[model samples]
Target: MAPKHQPLRTALIGLSSTAATSWASRAHLPNLLTEQGRSKFTITALQNSSVEAAQAAIKHYNLPPDTKAYGTPEDLANDPDIDVVICNTRVDKHFETVLPSIRAGKDVFIEWPIAQDLAHADELVEAARKSGSRVGIGLQRRWLPPVLKLKELIQGGSLGKVLTADVSFYNGEEDPTVLPEKLFYFTEKRYGGNPIVILGGHSLDYIFSVLGNLVPESISSQMQIRRPEVKLVDPATGKTIKTVTRDTPDILHFTARLQPSQYVVPGASFHYVFRSGQPFPGTPTANFTITLESGQIQLTAGSPPGLEFAGPGQEAKIKVWRRGSKEAEDVEWKWENVNDEIGPIAAAMQVPLYAFADGKEKGDGWVDIEDAREIARLIDGFYKKWEQDGGL
Candidate 1:
């Protein structure tokens, strides 16, 4: 009800002061403060666990003086002036945090892992469908410059038909051996933000989304926890706080045949290995090798290796090796004009939010609740396959 075509009045959920819990503030605030963000939406309100928390966040973010604050999802969702609600709560809290907003017919954007599990994600999908609310999932890695460039190259036949892909990603930064006190929840599968979901899920989502929307035909997977316990550390002092039994898989290796599609060659085999701890010595954090009939393309980075965001300096570059070429060529890729403070991650995130705000763009890269459900299915499939093989 804020006049048609005018900037949407938006409410932010889970924008806290702590860096560990406030991913929304870290990745979103920059883009939301940009010229494009300002033109498309306004931060009209905030909701945290308590009214004081919400008010503190609003003050900390330096949002407008009149920005409203609410302590609960229901209160925030019921605000008639709010046109959009963006939730950046923990993975396990996703369902409850955004359900009321979606049901209230408020456009909602949720961080990935859309919900704790596929069942919850399915319900949210159905709810969004019934409510006819635009729900954006934070599966924004596909919008990264390198990803789009790969898509362009593939569709344009720069790499010929992709016959197979081998993705070996080692999440070195957030290793399985240790967790900061703040991130200890990640060691448990119950939290739903384990390596399989964070590293494997997001990476696979981007990889397949760029590769002609390929779906897994038949997947065989193995999961193992190399570490029995993970040491919890005081993030500030790097001192060990305590240890908890590791309930999450540290090594996940899966091989699958992708269903034939317009882009991928028939019988395309996709092999993925997502390791929880440090990368093998002298190796990149993540290595994605796409084998095409004519040449090969590999994207290696020391960041998440998932290519969600860039690593330090030239570590995030992609190299293209044609069959006849002496060596691979470094492909040039860059993001559009973004605020300097936003960095590559937020800049990548801006695409989906902009698409949502404009309400014009559509397709595979535009991740909605339905697409989130699909990704959740993909995530669930891996676990099912792992269970079928029996736990390690």
Candidate 2:
């Protein structure tokens, strides 16, 4: 790893925008500044459409007073001291906002979906390629602890000949009219829809990162929007409202074929289900489960410490069972604090950078423009298929 003191100087552009404000101000920026964060990087500049908002954010976060605040993304991108450009703009504005930085040969770390559509994402990737820039998309789940453990067990052959795989998630999507404006694109056909294109995209990325070589042979799905009366209220004024319409699918359920080999038995099948906005009364709040040919591994979270604002009783558990045995054994992992399992999450965040840094040290890096393009292709293809399915 590079010397901690020689950290990268990063200029954050467009964070004051509503789309990036909460997550950037609360999670991304703080993580970048703390010791547990990228000790080698500092937020050298803050760019926003509104200088006042940026000023308030900087003060709220207790960032260095000298951190330059700009009224536009271009201003921050052009700063000579900025070695990296962090793009946290809205889902639709990423390409436009980050392209200039790429043209200027600055490394970029942006949130997922890269853009509302693949072409825009590809345009940014092409610019990055021409400029020899590094691009890192925020698919942080790949760096989460439970996932790492699952990867180890699967790769180590602990779950010999892995069999069927299933993934499911319920993200609130029922009331379209009452939905927040910021989240409305999530349901608009123009923007990537529910789990399939959005969550499913991340899920597939993680799946491929760990499982390797799993591809979609066929996808059949049905989609619906339960709530259309939802309205988006202005954050500052609860009285103001905007009603929008969305044609995006709220539910995505599909099945895929996993190559039959020593990993499992022949004809291994994978199933995935994603739903939006459903109440979980007696069920576990959040769960990521990996059921193997031999047994199953489950990660569960409750209340204060879990990711997302889930209700109480958060815990992480692992269960194992030998093939052909009815009995199963379970083990529990440690939590770093009462508010978050962030210790493990924070540690996991370093893997990508470590991989990239190691590659850089060896005159090679794992993250590049091409990888971003490939991810874009995957996102594009998934949506195309969804559309062809008659919004199923």
Candidate 3:
């Protein structure tokens, strides 16, 4: 590891005490405060919907008294002290929230599904390129220990001649009965909060990172809105708020055949299915199965109703069964062993952050904005296929 020099000054947008339990607070903030992370980065500014909210978050997190609080993203972007801008806002607001920072030529890290749609994503990419600013997306699953190990095992020829891969993700969020008032925005596909982009996209990124990027030869998809009318519940009172009609598809299934590529025999393929709103009762939230000529590898991660970030008490498990071995071998991974200061999810997230910082310092250590745009295009393909097939 390079010796720490000046810490990267960072500003977090859409982070506040009001949403204290958000992914940003749980994963990003905690990781940044760790001893190891603090050595590399410093939280110099915070932006929320209002100055009062930002100030409250500063006090709640007990940040340095000198940390600046801004009501608008423009103010934070204009602050020369900030070296990187981290945006954790909703997908719909991503383009606007990150635009000012890009225009100011500042490196930015935006959470996954970079924008509401491909058009918005293209605009951001163009702006970043023109300004020569580095952009990082929150596709941190590739950095997870199990994922890294899987990639290493495949690349090292442990899973010789990969044949096929299957991934299934089931979360009960799409259920109309469990909808929350605050999350009603997710019912609209235009907001880019559907399961296909959130869960399926992450799973696809994980698969591609391990098997190497494959060109899609063909694609078939099906989408349906099982629960059109959803009842919203108030978290505080545990009472029903109101019912709203939802048009977004709650269930999505897609399969694609890849051209003969690396990491596998001539015709390796991929298939994924994501279902939301349906109750899983007592089943794992996510599972991955990869088959190769020599053996098979399986992974189980997160719990029921799983969000992208692995929740507290949830750990990932991986098992490998080779043709010659009598019994499957369990793979163990501890993030503490890699970096004691940060949690597993945070450690994964730190990969992109470190890469972004390194690119700023050393000139080339981050995922390209073009790669992020490609993922966005892949997502666009899914929606297009659904429409062409006459969505259920």
Candidate 4:
């Protein structure tokens, strides 16, 4: 059921070391390069704002000599060989970089926040719509097997009624001053706003992915600045420097309502918690508890890949039990990676990508997009309520 067109052509437009390792290197490149993905797309080129950086990455990855390396976004956009552009770049530069590709009728996969706010995301959504190009946001967690299973169970009537559900996360990294400078992505808000917009956006987006559609009735959030500032030494000279004015919220808490009781996954409520600067001692861990009208399910997700950036000991576990049943059973699934599972988890989570590439999964490609946009709208709704309530 592959696409009628020949294999999709792809290129990487930002080759920073961070982008190389964080995503393109770990998941996108490796997964797409597989024999299975080879049938769908080929990684044709690498680009960067700097020629030296792009060339170094090309040589380091040992790409073919014909592989093009660019010193600017325009160069890559003009390269007719690339049909799909994967952009992993600075947050501020996302809208600018991806717009060119959209104009050229090349589909694009861009990092999250699509832009700093809703207007940009909508604009990008509209441009792609007009150009007949596909746009993918890198919120890969929605594709996880466990999540998909949960969604299916609800949709299939196995859960009967998902009465209430909760999702929570904890890891130690509360102090922004101590984090690496490159992590400004999380620390800066005006560029993309705070964790509520960034981190919470991803988690909430996935929750919407599971629930189908949501109408956020109310939202309340609080942000705290624990350290205020931090010092870092020059990597080469060992000179110390202090940074000031960390405005983003390291901690975010909120709640919203699901739309239409009819669409409610039967017995569902969501609770999410995230803690930074307080790393759990063992492996990184994420867990959720669910209560169904007939059965109960508990899920714990291990911190994989970039989560390691949050620090060690990551694992995922899902346990289920029938009401009044004597015993509980654990559902076992394969781990995607040994060194760093974030890649594998992300790969597994990309269910829609495979569905789209295969051409037979059902619905237009935007089935997931519809779910995501509704979630985005809800989150925006929550933010508006927060503004009304003096949350800022």
Number of the predicted model whose TM-score against the real structure is largest: 1
Q: What 10-residue stretch in candidate 4 is worst by lDDT?
A: 304-313
Superposed Cα deviation of residue 364, candidate 4 (Å): 7.6
Q: Give the per-residue lDDT digits (tens) of candidate 1, residues 121-200.
A: 88888888898887888888887888888888888876678899998888776556778898887887778887778767
* Model 1, runs deviating above 4 Å: 1-4, 213-217, 306-308
lDDT of each: 0.80, 0.60, 0.75, 0.61
Candidate 4 lDDT by residue in tens digits, 290-388: 677788777665662223232233445667788788998887744444233235534543444555554543333323333445545755665565556
Estimate TM-scores for all models.
Answer: 0.94, 0.81, 0.89, 0.81
Model 1, position 52, has a per-residue lDDT of 91
Worst 10 residues of 1 by lDDT: 306-315
lDDT, model 4, position 310:
24
Where model 3 places Cα greater than 4 Å from the true spot, the runs are 1-5, 172-176, 277-283, 302-314, 324-326, 337-341, 360-366
Residue 270's lDDT within candidate 1 is 88
Give the top-scoring candidate (lDDT): 1
In model 1, what is the error at residue 13, expressed in angstroms? 0.3
In candidate 2, stretches whose alpha carbon ends up further than 4 angstroms from where it belongs are 1-5, 17-21, 36-38, 172-177, 191-196, 219-222, 226-229, 233-242, 259-266, 285-291, 298-311, 335-369, 372-375
Model 4 stretches astray by more than 4 angstroms: 1-4, 17-21, 155-159, 171-177, 193-195, 220-227, 230-240, 260-268, 279-284, 302-313, 335-346, 349-371, 381-392
Winner by lDDT between candidate 4 and candidate 2: 4
lDDT at 84, model 2:
74
